[model samples]
Target: MYEQFTKPILDYSIALVMFLLLSPVILLVSILLAISHRGNPFFLQERPGKDGKIFQIIKFKTMRDLTDVNGKQLSDYERLTLMGKIVRKTSLDEIPQLLNVLKGEMSLVGPRPLLPEYWTLYSEEQRRRHDVKPGITGWAQINGRNALSWEEKFRYDLEYVDKISPRMDAKIVLVTLEKVVKRHGVNANNYMTMEAFKGNVA
Candidate 1:
C-alpha cells in the first residue's frame, strides 16, 4: 500500500523540499566546479532505473578532461580536479541527483543505480536490484558502499528489495546522514573510486 502510493508522494514532496533548501549550497558548488573543470558544471549519464528502464542521472562534474601522450583519458585519480576532491569527499557531487528524484526517475531510497553497460552482466538474482527505483543512497551505501565486493553489495541490494518499508527507509536515511557527516566509507578500499564489477565469477 505504502510502496505504491505513499512512497512516491513522500519522495516527491521531500525531494522538492530538499532541492529548495539546498539550492544555495548547490549554486555555490556549481560555481566552484565550473571554475575548476572549466566547462559544464553538471554531469549526466544514462543509468538503469526501475525495471531496467534507462534514465539520465544528474551529478556534479568532478573530473577534468586530460589525456596522455597516447590520447587516452587519464585514470580517475589523475582526472580528479582540486574542487572535485572536495566535492567528492563531501558527497556534494550527488546533490544534483535530486533533479532525478523530482523527475520520478529515482527515489530518495533504494538500491543505487549502476552503469547501463553492466545490465547484461547482472545475474538473474543481481538484476533484482532494479525491481525498484534506484536511489541516491541505500543499505549497501551505509554498510560499506564501495568498500563491499560486488557479491556483498548485491546481497544488501536484494535484501532491501525484499524488506523495503517506510521504517527501513527511515533508518537508512538517518544512518546515511550520520555516515555522510562523518565522511565514512565514501571511497572503496584502496581505490580512487569503487572498482568496476567485471561480472560474477564462474
Candidate 2:
C-alpha cells in the first residue's frame, strides 16, 4: 500500500516542501559553485535507475575540472576545492537531488544510484539494487555508507528491496538523519570518496 500509492505521494510532497525550505541554501551553494566552477554549478551524470533505465542525476558541483599536464583529470582529492570540501562534508552537495525526487527519477529512500558503467560490473544479485528508484540516501547509506565494503553495501540494498515497508522506511529515515547530523561515514578512511566498486573476485 505505501510503496505503491502512499510512498510516491509522500515522496513528492516531502520533496517539494524540502526544496522550498532549502531554496536559500541551494541558491547560496549554487552561486558559490558557479563562481568556483566558472559558471557551472550543477553536475549532471547519467545513472542507472529503476529497471536499469538511465537518467541524469543532478548534484552540486563539488570538484574543479583541473587537469594534469597530460590533460587527464586530477584525482578527486586534488580537484576538490576548499568550498567543495565544506559542502561535501556538510552534505549540502546532495541537496539538488531533491529535484530528482520531485521529477520522479528518484525517491527519498532506496538504493543509491551508481555510475552507469558499473551496471556491467554488478553481479546478478547486486544488480537488484536497481529494481526500484534510486534515492539520495538508502539502507546502505544509513548502515555504513562509504565505510562498508561493496559486498556489504549490496547486502543492505537487497535487504531493503525485500523488506520495504513504511515501518522500515521510517527507521531508515530517522537513522539517516542521525548519521548526517554526526557527519559520519561521509568518506572512506583513506580515500577522498568511496573507492570505486570493482567486480567481486573469486
How many clashing pairs per prediction, in order? 0, 0
Candidate models: Cα lDDT each: 0.93, 0.91
The top-ranked prediction according to lDDT is 1
TM-score of every prediction relative to native: 0.98, 0.97
Estimate, for each residue in 1-202, the C-alpha lDDT of model 1 and write its tens digit: 8878999999999999999999999999999988887889999899999999999999999998889999998889899988999998999999999999999999999999999999999999999999999999999999899899999999999999999999999999999999889999978876778998899899
Question: Across residues 43-67, which tens digit of lDDT does each residue of candidate 2 receive?
Answer: 9999999999999999998898889
State each model's C-alpha RMSD to the native.
Answer: 0.8, 1.0
Q: Least accurate stretch of 10 residues (summed lDDT) in model 1? A: 185-194
* Candidate 2, residue 83: lDDT: 87
Give Cα distance to truth, residue 185, candidate 1, Å. Answer: 0.7
